[model samples]
Target chain A: GAGVSQSPRYKVAKRGQDVALRCDPISGHVSLFWYQQALGQGPEFLTYFQNEAQLDKSGLPSDRFFAERPEGSVSTLKIQRTQQEDSAVYLCASSISGALGGELFFGEGSRLTVL
Target chain B: AQSVAQPEDQVNVAEGNPLTVKCTYSVSGNPYLFWYVQYPNRGLQFLLKYITGDNLVKGSYGFEAEFNKSQTSFHLKKPSALVSDSALYFCAVRGLQTGANNLFFGTGTRLTVIP
Candidate 1:
């Protein structure tokens, strides 16, 4: 089976610009998660979705960050007015169930560089 | 609050020698611990997880993790290190007792297996 996939493996954006990263979860996955990883650091949670419902967005660092999963199959993480501090690899993961114990499959991630 | 800790910034091991990557966690209640690995320029891949009923959990690529309730540790181990095993390792924890759907990740540990 194909693993989770993210588009635009690398993106360079100017400060104050808006950018969108896409994620395609594994087929039939019901849970999707987004994370941010700074250089030399582990990933930090961003948001979560169970099907089309955005279950948690508390981990989002600021209001500039937004995410949506309209149909529950593909998801997008959008950053408005990007800042240099937002430079990092954005990761997406999906799991079969919404349970905390379910194994998550991750994608290669989209590396965004804001200058 | 739920959190995970990887005390070592890096671990170096000689090929054919045993290797260990330590992780400790703190949460309000019983936790579900997991291990993930990421090669350079790649996404995180699930290695193993400890949910319940077992202290020793075996995972992909001859890797295993031992869950210690007393120490609140889940240290990843491999009997014989291979150069290909060199990568960044992450430890994650979620509070199963509270049904928290979020995973708290530790500051990852870089593992270098010298051939």
Candidate 2:
């Protein structure tokens, strides 16, 4: 695809339910990132992957949040036992070099609503 | 820890007038700064970044940002505003200790260009 793609643009989950959001980055992007954007707030970093390695996940709010990029091109974010506070737009982005100053290409995020 | 701040919750500008969105950041070392724009129901779109070059950085849609290390600020500016430019703007920063992969963002500012 010409741009990053995300699945289930909108997700409504019951409290305690498990939900998964997927991201397919640009064809050759090397760095993938996950962020959570709460209403009226900027996106907060959740996790980062370099190739298939989960290099940084220091931003995951709790144990319920998990993310993986098994093959390096596609990634999934899983939230277990979802809570109302988990409601937000989950954004996925990818960069070609993974450099600190590189611009990222973002996908249309998946808006998750936990009831 | 690296952090960015966007003090204004919202900003309004008349079409054809100049517009500015202020941002300030704190980091342990030389910072990597970025600006992103988000339209309603869409993901972030990259605008510009300030790495190690001249303080002025130009980006998409005739937008530009000025990096002021003395003030720890990176303010987004446009010479002429358009109603179509109304959107949410975000500022982000990454420091050496935070690694090159993860970005810390500030609460966004909603820009309204009134016709």
Q: Interface Cα RMSD per model, in Å?
A: 1.2, 0.9
lDDT of model 2, residue B109: 94
Model 2 lDDT per residue over B14-110, tens place: 9999999999999998999999999999999999999998999999999999999899999999999999999999999998988867888889999
**Deviation from native of the Cα of residue A88 in model 1, angstroms:** 0.4
For model 1, residues A1-115, the per-residue Cα lDDT tens digits are 4999998899999999999999999999999999999999999999999999998998899999999999999999999999999999999999999887888899999999999
lDDT of 1 by residue, B1-115 (tens): 7788999999999999999999999987788889999999999999999989889999999999999999999999999999999999999998854354577889999999998
DockQ, candidate 1, vs. native dimer: 0.76
Provide the clash count, candidate 2. Answer: 0
For candidate 1, the TM-score is: 0.98
Model 1 chain A worst lDDT window (10 residues): A96-105
**Native interface contact recovery, all models:** 0.70, 0.85
Model 1: residue A111 alpha-carbon error in angstroms: 0.3
